[model samples]
Target: MKLVTLAIICVLMLNSCKNKSQEEPQNQVKVEKIEYASFGKEIVASDAIAAKSMASHYKTMKTGDSIDSKMVAKVNNVCQAKGCWMRLDLDDGNEVMVKFKDYGFFVPKDITGKEVIINGKAFVKEVSVDEQRHYAEDAGKSAEEIAKIIEPKRTYSFEADGVLVVQ
Candidate 1:
């Protein structure tokens, strides 16, 4: 009986040990209420909060750098069907495509011309023709318009986890 008890204790101790691979941090969402809310959804998180990055600052940064930039920029356009994506004016007729990280969240659809602060990682990418057409479709562009995308284009992209529309 004592041997069985000792063996049970040993098994219990082994079972209590934690694996290091399971120690990764989780994205805990914190809700933030807005006194004067815009057309978009309320702020769901404040992760890695930062001030907006300047357009020129983006132009100066090297590609592939891990950027957690909080940028305040004008909304050029949005995915009209759904707020799954948006384009922010980066000055000089340039724009950066903003998408939600992991398809986790979406912005307001009618937020065009409004100012928004986005928190995300920014990088430059060569978007393929197929994907560009898919984005155009998501934007509710005409079939002719999507067909116009024949070549891949290089542009800055941001994968945002949080977005706040400025008043």
Candidate 2:
């Protein structure tokens, strides 16, 4: 009788341990894989506004005024020289010039026409003629086209802390 009782207790303990082990994985949180190529800082592709909405927000902003935002847009152009900057289409005729924060990161130069999510500060600024010409040069524009950027232009700009190029 004593041997049977000991055997029964051991089996019960083993069963309980097995049950606990089986329940652990079910209680664990699931982690989702990121599908974007990240740059600068790691950022998830969540809560980003559409390009059209982002354009509207830019329209309401003035020079020197900025707002923290996350937006998704199509890459219209990128700096051909070294991928230092990019232009994103706002679903409108206007494009927003995006530069990485602190010049810390650069997106792939061949990523034009790809969708990207950017997290940063959006602001309106008057870009000087010299700067415009410089950018035109970096874009590999013709000499005449660079010369045409003779006027200071007010434009939408973003300083991105993080960027994710959709793969």
Candidate 3:
């Protein structure tokens, strides 16, 4: 009976240690809001929060960089359909399409002329011609308009979670 009790006590002690070791650090990292650049402006992420959380934050991309989760520049273009989205231009000369999250909020179409900050993932992809046409249709474009929709050769797409609209 004594040996069984000792064995159980050892197991419990080991389990407790294991659990404690698996716990995360007490000091957690907080995401800070940041602003990006414009079409011609050379704005960049000048904050520490962006530096620590995202490795590629504010770094210019040549290719294969998707604008999904990164602080990126705002592209210069207005969503002509419903004035819902403000596009962002990435450092790689790739246009990162920016829109409010969950359709919860929207910026003025004229805001496209300003600088903004976005935190999200960046995806470099070639959207199929069909998908492009579909988007064009959704934007209330005519068949000729849909045909004019430029198929994405390679786009650095940014899907922002939280955005800080900066002038």
Candidate 4:
């Protein structure tokens, strides 16, 4: 009787182990292939809000307010001199100025019109005329265009920890 009980327990343990092994594969998550060119800290392209939604968030933000977020948008322009900064179209007429965090990374200068996902802190601020002119120069704007930035402008800004340019 004792021998029979021990054999039953052994059989049950073996069966349970077999079941767990079979279930392991099903429980594993599928990792999709990465198809983006990465810059700065690596980031996955998941859970990023669309440009339209991001625009709405910006609309609700006041100057000095900031939120941590990830968003996808089309590149409207890039710093012509060094790709140090980029402007992303929010699907509306508004564009968000994105700069790398800690001056850590730069994107491709010719990425205009390409889609990208950026992980960052978004904020609204008043851009000084001098800074505006500086950015305009970086963008290779004409002297007349730079000169026209006389007044401070309220702008949507982002400090991106990572950027993924969709291929």
| lDDT top scorer | 4
The candidate 3 region of ten consecutive residues with least summed lDDT is 48-57
Quote each prediction's TM-score: 0.66, 0.79, 0.49, 0.79
Clashes per prediction?
Answer: 2, 0, 20, 0
lDDT by residue for model 2 over 1-167, one digit each (tens)? 99999999999999999999999999999997858999998888899999999999989888999999999999999999889999999998999999999999999999999999999999999999999999999998999898777689999999999999988
lDDT of each residue in 44-140, candidate 1, tens digit only: 3344233234556567776665566767678989998778899988766788899988887777787899877777688877899999999989888
Please provide, for model 4 over 42-90, each residue's C-alpha lDDT reduced to its tens digit, 9 standing for 90 to 100. 9999999999999999999999999999999999999998899999999
Worst 10 residues of 1 by lDDT: 36-45
lDDT of 3 at 23: 77
User: How large is the C-alpha RMSD of every model relative to the true structure?
Assistant: 16.6, 7.1, 15.9, 7.5
Model 1 clash pairs? 52-70, 52-71
Model 3 global lDDT (CA atoms, 0 to 1): 0.56
What tens digits encode model 3's per-residue C-alpha lDDT throughout 63-83? 556544546354477566665
Q: Is candidate 3 or candidate 4 better by lDDT?
A: 4
Candidate 3 matches the true fold with a TM-score of: 0.49
Worst 10 residues of 2 by lDDT: 32-41
